[model samples]
Every structure is written in C-alpha cells, then in structure tokens.
Target: MALLETRDLTKEFGGLRALDRVNIAVERGELVSLIGPNGSGKSTLINTITGMLEPTAGDITYAGTDLVGMKPFEIAQLGVGRSFQTASIFPELTVSENVEVAAFAAEHDSFSVNFFRRRDAYDEVRERTDHILETIELDAKAEETAEALPYGDKRRLEVAIGLATGPDLMFMDEPTAGMSPGETEMTVSLIRELLEDWGMTIFLVEHDMDVIFDVSDRIFTLHEGQVIARGPPEEIRDDPAVREAYLGGEEA
Candidate 1:
C-alpha cells in the first residue's frame, strides 16, 4: 500500500468547491510534488489531508488507516509532519529551544503534565534536537535567537522543527519561498539529503519551477481545484494542459 493515499477527496466552502474529488498517492521514499497556480486548491489539499481542515467528502488514509476526523496532533502522532510556506518558527526563542519543543511534543502526549519541566530534564528530546540541528547545519547557531537569523536560516529552522518530530512522511509547503538563489540552492541540498540520506517521503507544494523539476520524482498539476496532469518531471514540463493552465502556454 502507498504510505499516503487520498481517494476522491473533496472540500467545499459554501457554494464554492476548493477541492473537487482529488486523488493522489505517495509511495515510501519518494518526493512527490503538487503544483498549481494560486487558488488552485494546493493549500486546501494539504490542510485537509493534515487535518487542519475537514474534508467535505471522500477518504484519506495514511499507512492504511482512515485519517478523516483525526485532529492535527492526532495525525502528527501517527508519524506525519509538515513545514509551512512561511517560516513558522518562534522568533523569540533560541534555535535549540525551538527544536527541543517540537521533539518534546512528539515524545509526550500530555503537555499539561510535562510542560513545566525543565527542558534539560528530557535527555532524549535534547539528543534528538541536537541531532536535527546538526543535520540541518544549524548547530553553529543553536544558541542564537530565531529572530536573529537570516530569512533563509529561519526557513531551515522550520524544516528542522518538522524533522524533530521524527516523521516518516513530511509535507513541505514552499520551503524555498522568498529565498535568494544561494539560499534556495542550500535548501534544495537539504531536501535532497532528507530524501537520499534520511530516507524520507516528501509531499511538496512549491512555486519554484526549477526546484520542483530538480527534486520531484513525480509531479501533479492542479488547475481550478482539480488535477489537470500528473507525470514525471519531463512529461509534466511538456504537458499541453499544464502549459496552458499553469505555464502561460509556454515551455517551463
């Protein structure tokens, strides 16, 4: 079975449909990308699958278990994790603290019970946090405040926070947004490490055509709340429907 599967998933807001009977799957150890123009339901699909929004209809399964009705934390506990389009880090906190918090949340179900404890009290959480920082090349700045870092580093910190959750499948939403060329290259390398070295399965939504084409094993193109095309990168780049809908009828 696929690691994650959505069968005919649909979501609507009043009279309008945000997602219309969408079907997609991600196998283990693959980097699958979802591409679409703004308002094409890319965010909606991620929110629905990750339990941030309830689906209006259809089935979502992760590791063969129904995901509908599960809370966001409930889904996280099942080994799913995500990073946002914008950098979603706690600016005031030190970089290490941010990662420790995520690792702590993943290890303990009840925050009320352990929330007041000293962060150092949890040896495993600290170790995992340290490991993630090293892996993401943020250990050198571990003690710096998140707000003090450069924009690209802030985004990398967000990815590290997601990694601290120990996910088998990760959903990354535009991890390279607002980055310089050099920063984007760094993030791409990190993503490649996550897939190749750590053996992670990723579902990504991104606007950067270069990054998408370079990293994705398969690409799904959405137009007007439905998938218009899906194929390998070369095929997606040349697809007539994708060209018309997303690429301005020009080559990507």
Candidate 2:
C-alpha cells in the first residue's frame, strides 16, 4: 500500500473549488515534490490532508488508515508531521527548548497539561530533542535563543523541531524559500542526507525549480487547482504541459 494516498480528494469554498478531483499516491520511503504557481491548491491539499481544513470530498489514507476527520494532533500521533514554507520556530525560546516543547507533546500522553512541572522529567522528550538537534547539526546552538541564530540556521531549526515529533512521514513546505544560492544548496544536501541516513519519507512543496528537480524522486505539477503532470524527474523535465506552464513560460 502507498504510505499516503489521496483518492479524488477535493475542497471547496462557497462557489469555488480549491482542489478538484486530485488523486495522488506517495509510496513508503519516497521523496515527492508538489509544485505550482500561486493559488494552484498545493498548500490547500496539505491543509486538507493534515486536518488544518476539512475537505469537501474524497479520501485521505495514511498507512492504510482513513484520515478524513482526524484532528491535527491526532494525525501527528499517527506518525505524520509537517513544517511550513516559513520558519515557524519560537523566537524567544532557546533552540533546544523549542524542539523539546514539540517532542514532549508527542512523547507523552496527548492530554499533558502540567506546565508547572519540570520538563526534564520527560526523558523521551529531552532525548529526542538532543537527537534532532544533532541530526540538523544544531547541537552547538542548543543553548542559543532561536532569534539569535542566522537566518539559514533558524530555518533548519524549524525543521528540526518538526523532526523531534518522530514522524515517519515528513512534509516540508518550501524549506529553501528566500535563501541565497549557497544556502539553498546546503539545505538540499541536508534533505538528501535525511533521506539517506534516517529512512524518512518526505512530501515537499517547492518553488525553486532547480532544487525540486534535483531533490525529488517524483514531481507533481498543479495548475488551476488540478494536477497537470506527474513523473520521475527526467520525465517531468521533459513533459510538454509542465514545460509550457512553468519552464517554457515567457518569464521562465
């Protein structure tokens, strides 16, 4: 079975449909990229699959379980987690503390509300936090405030925080957004390392054509709320419709 599958999944708002009859399947251990121009429903699909929004119609199956009505936290507990296009870390917290916060919630029972208790009591959280920091090469900055890190490191920290949740499937929404060429390249290398070393599955939405082309095992292109193309990197690169809509556009 596919690790994550969406069969005719769709969403609508009033008279307009944000996603239309989308059918996508991501295999276990695969690295897939979703690409589209603005308003093409890439983020909408993520929101629907993650329960940030309810879909108008269709099925979402993760690990062969139906996910149509599950809550975001419930989905997280099922070993699926996601990060955003922007750095979504806590600026005031130390880098380690930010990761610990998410790790704590994921490791403990879902109803943990004891804020007065010391966080160190949660050994799993602390251990996972430390492990994720090392994975992202941020252990040296574990004690530093999140806001104090350079821009590139801050972005990586946000992803590390997501990693602390210990998800088998991770969705990264444009992890390389707004970075210099060098920074983008480094982040791409880090993602490849994550796949090679950690055995993690990935779903990504990206705008940098070069990065998506280089890093993706498969690429799906969306246009006007529907899938225009999907294939291996080489096939996607050669697809005429995708080329016309994105790579062959006058601006491109």
Best by lDDT: 1
Q: Estimate TM-scores for all models.
A: 0.93, 0.91
Residue-level lDDT of model 1, residues 16-62, one tens digit each, is: 89999999988999999999888889999999999999999999999
Model 2 C-alpha lDDT per residue in residues 1-252, reported as the tens digit of each score: 899999998899898898999999999888999987777889999899998999999999999999999998899889898874344687899999999877776766454666327565577577778888887888999999989989888888878877877889999988888878887887898788778888999999988889998989999998767999999999988888987776554445
Model 2 TM: 0.91
Each model's RMSD to truth, in Å? Answer: 2.7, 2.6
Model 1's number of clashes is 0
Model 2 stretches with alpha carbons more than 4 Å out: 85-88, 109-121, 247-252
Q: Give the lDDT of residue 82 in candidate 2.
A: 88
Model 1 misplaced regions, further than 4 Å: 85-88, 110-121, 247-252
